[model samples]
Target: MQGNSEVLVIDDHMKRKQQVELLLQFIGEPCKLVSSANIGEVLTEQVAWRAVVVGQVDIGSPFELVSQLAGQYKAQPFLLIGELGDCVADLPNVIGSVLEPFSHSQMTQMLHRCQDYHLKAPSKTKPTSQHQEILFRSLIGRSGGIQQVRQLIEQVAVTEANVLVLGDSGTGKEVVARNIHYMSARRSGPFVPVNCGAIPPDLLESELFGHEKGAFTGAISARKGRFEMAQGGTLFLDEIGDMPLNMQVKLLRVLQERCFERVGGSTSIDADVRIVAATHRNLEGMIDKGDFREDLFYRLNVFPIEMPSLSERREDVPLLMQELIERLASDHKVTIRLTERALDSLMEHTWPGNVRELANLVERLVILFPNGLIDVNDLPSKYRHVDAPEYDHEYDESLLEQDMLNDVFQNDVYEPPESSMSTQLPPEGLNLKEMMTELEIDMINQALETTDWVVSRAADLLGMRRTTLVEKMRKYSLSKDSA
Candidate 1:
C-alpha cells in the first residue's frame, strides 16, 4: 500500500507489526491488521485490499497464513514481508519478501505491484472482460478479419473449451494460443508449444507424452514431455494436421479422458492441461482422404478460430511492419524506416507466406540498411513493384550535374543517390557500425579541412549543430594540431 488505500496485513509478532505500521504510515498508506477475531469481517467486507502482507512468527509453517488467506480469497496477491518462507514458490502470486529491515524502495516496489494487481484485477463472477493492451498486442490490426480473430480469441480464452486455430502458414496461430493461455484462469501456469509436424513420426508420442525410465533404448532416465511441462497451462499443438494417425488416437484419448500415462508406465498421470491446436492444412480434406481420424478432429475442433492471411488483411502491413521493426530494433540495437512508396509497393504484392514473410523482410532490411531510410527500389527484386532510375536510361549527360544541382536548391527535389552506394554487399557480411563510423570520420575530416578547421563553418557544411560537431570532435579526440 503506497497511498490511502487500505492493505491487509497478517503479522503475529509485535515488533515487526509496529515496524510495518510505521512504514505504512510513512508511505501514507492505511493498513488493516487482520487478527483471529476480525479475519471473517475483513474478508467478508465489500472492499478490495491493495494487497495482503504476510509476516508469520513461525518459520516452521511460513505458508500457514498464506494458505488461510488463499482459501478465503484465491486471487488475493500475497506479499511475504521479512522472510520468503518455504513453499512460497508453490504459489505464483506470492511476492518476494523484504530483507530484515524493509527499505523504502523495496517496500514501495512490492506495494506498487499490489496496486497494479488492483488495477488489472478480474471480475469475481467472470474472467476479465477488459482487453488488456499487453495481452492482445500481438493481434495488431484494424481490419474486420483481424478484429474478428481477436474477438474470437477473447471469447474462447475465458472458457475451458479446446481451441482449433485454422489458417494459412505464418498466420500467427501460436500467437492466438499464447494470448488465450495468458488471459485464462491458468495464466500463472506454463505455456508449452510443440510443433506436431517438426517431430519425427516415430518419436512424436514420446515428445508429447513423456517416456518413463527404460521405456525405450534412448530413455536413459525418466523425462517429462510437453503435456507434463504444461500441467496447469495451455499446450499449443502446432500443425496438428501433420500428427501421425496412430498418435492422433492417443492424443484424442488423452483429450477426452483428461489424463494420460507415460510410455511404459501403467499409473495414469492427471493431465490438467488445456489444449490449443493449430493447422494450416485442411483437416476435413485429410479426414476424407483417411489420413486424419474424424473422432480426433471433432475433439480438437471444439472452438474453431480462423486466422486471416496477410493478403486478407493487407491494410495491416504498415502497422505490422512498425511493430516488427520496433521488436527487431530492440533485439539488434538498430532500426530502419520504410517510405510510403515502399509500404505501398509491399501492400501491392500479394504475401504468399503471410505475416511471417513480412517479418523476415523487415528483419532483412534492418540488417541491410541499419538506421537508414528505405524506398521501393531498395527492396528485393521479387518484392519490388517500383523501379529506380538506371544508368542506361536516356537522359541529358552534359547538363545532368548542373540541372540536378539547380533542382536541389530551387525545386527542393533532392533524393538519395542510389548509384553512389555499393550495388552489391559482400558474401561475408559487412560491419554496418564500423563502416558508418569510418564514413562519418572521412566526411568530418573533409569538411574540417575544406573549411580551414573553422568549427562553425565545418558544422554548417556537415548540416549539424555546432555543439553536436564539438561533441563528435571530442569523442574522436580530434584537434587542429593532430589534423
Candidate 2:
C-alpha cells in the first residue's frame, strides 16, 4: 500500500522506467504501464488489472508494496527486476525475474505463464478451442442478460452441480462452460470438451468412454476417451441434443451410476469428472418427438443456464467488438478500425450467428484491411443496414494513423490538433490557457468516443497517464455514458 504502480518500479537506479515499456512491447499484451508512481488505486481496483510491480530489496518498500497487493490480486502476477535474493524467493506472486538489462525472454515467459494462469484457468481444453485462441477470460458485457449468465456461472461453479447450458449456436455456450470449469475447484485439472454432434454415431461411445485394443475396427491401440481424460476436472459435452438416443441412454447411465467400463473391457473406471453439457437444440422438444431420453434431460439439467443471443443484448456490441479487436491484434498483429456509422450499422443488424458471427466478421475485416479504417460501405454487403456513402477507392490512411497514434502510446492517444488560428492576436486578447484547455477537452472527448469510453484505451489515445485522464475527466465533469 506504500507507493504502488500498475507495473510499479520501486525506487530504482538500475534502468527501471524504460525497461518496463520495452518488456511489455515484447510480450504483445496491451496493459497500462507506470513507473515509480501511485500504487494505491491499483490494489483496490478490479482484480483483472495485470502488471508486474518491480521492487528491489534495498529500494523504498517494494517488497512491502508487493507483499500487500499480492494476496488481493494473485492472478495479477509480478516480475521482480533486480539481483536474485532469497527474500522474494517465497513470495507466491513473484513469478519471474528481470535482470539489470531487462531480458525480453524473461518477460515473455512470465506472460506465457500468466496466460496459462489466465484468470485462474484458460489452458486450452483440447479440440474445444485453438491453443492460441486466448480470449477475454471475463465475458465482455454490461447488459442484463450477460450479467445473469455471469451470475449463473458464479453460482454453479463452486458447487458440484451438472450444468446444462442451453442457447442457440454461437451464443457462447462453450465460453460459459469454460468459465464454470476455470472457476471450479478442479481448475488445476484438464478441461476436456467433446462435441457430440461432430463425432459419428458409431464412434460417439468410443469418444466418451474410451476403448480397449481391438474393441472396434480401428481400435488397434487402447485410447482414453473424454471422460478418462477429464478425471478430476470438468467434461464438457457440447450439442447434447444432437446426441443419438442410444448414446443418450449410455450417458445417462454414467451420470446416474457415476462409473463406466471401457469398450471390450469388463473392469469399470470411476467417472470422477464433473459434467457440463450444452446444446443449441431444445431437449424437451426432442424428448416429445422421441429423439431424446427424458431421463437424460433431467440428469443434465440439474442447474440449467440459458444464454441470451447477441440480439438480446445489442448494447454490448461495442464492448464485445473492442475485446475481439484486441484479441485479434494480440494474436495476429493486425487491426481494423470501424467508423461510427459502421459500428452503428452493426449494432442494428440481427446477428443470427450471434457473437461468433461478429468475431468472424471482425477477423475477416482485419484480414482484408489490416490497418485500414472501415466505413459502413467497407463492411460486408449484408452488414450494411444504414445508408453509407460510396466507398472511396483512393482512401486516406492519415486519419486512421493519427487515431492509432492517439491510442497505442500505452494503447490509444490524442494528438494536439494543428491550430487554424494565426499567430497575430486579435484586438480583443483571448485567454490562451482557456483556449488550450477547451481544445484539450474536445480532443479527450473525441478519444473517448473513438474507444467507446474505455478509459484505459482513451488514456492511451491521449498519450497521457490514465490517472491524468481521470483527473481531467473529473475536472471537466466528462462522463462516457452521459457524453
Best by lDDT: 1
Error of 1 at 348 (Å): 0.5
**Cα deviation of 401, candidate 1, in Å:** 29
Off by over 4 Å in 2: 1-138, 390-483
lDDT (Cα) of model 1 = 0.73
Candidate 1 lDDT over residue span 1-483, tens digit each: 111246677777767777677566533356888644456666642545666787764443447767656556655667876566665656655756766545433565576565456545565512243233123333776566987887887778879999999999988999888888877888889999999999999889989988899998989999888999999999999999999999999998999899999898988999999999999999999999999999999999999999988897775676577667766765788977665447666866799999889888988998898877676778998888644443332444333323312312232232336885685789998997697777778788899999999766787798764435654676677768898
10 residues in a row with least lDDT, candidate 1:
404-413
RMSD of 1: 21.8
Most TM-score-accurate candidate: 2
- Which ranges of candidate 1 are over 4 A from the true structure? 1-130, 133-138, 387-483
Give the distance in Å from residue 435's predicted Cα in candidate 2 to where it truly belongs: 31
Tens digit per residue, CA lDDT, model 2, 1-483: 121212434434444454466455433334454445555544453434344546544546665656666665555566666653566667665666666444433454455454444434333311122222234532556566887887777778889999999998988999989988876788778999999999999999999999999997988999998999999999999999889888988998999999999898888999989999999987888889999999888999999999999998775675577668767777888876776457667877899999999989988999889977788888889998877687674766545423322322343243444685566778999998798789888889999999998766787787674535754776798886669
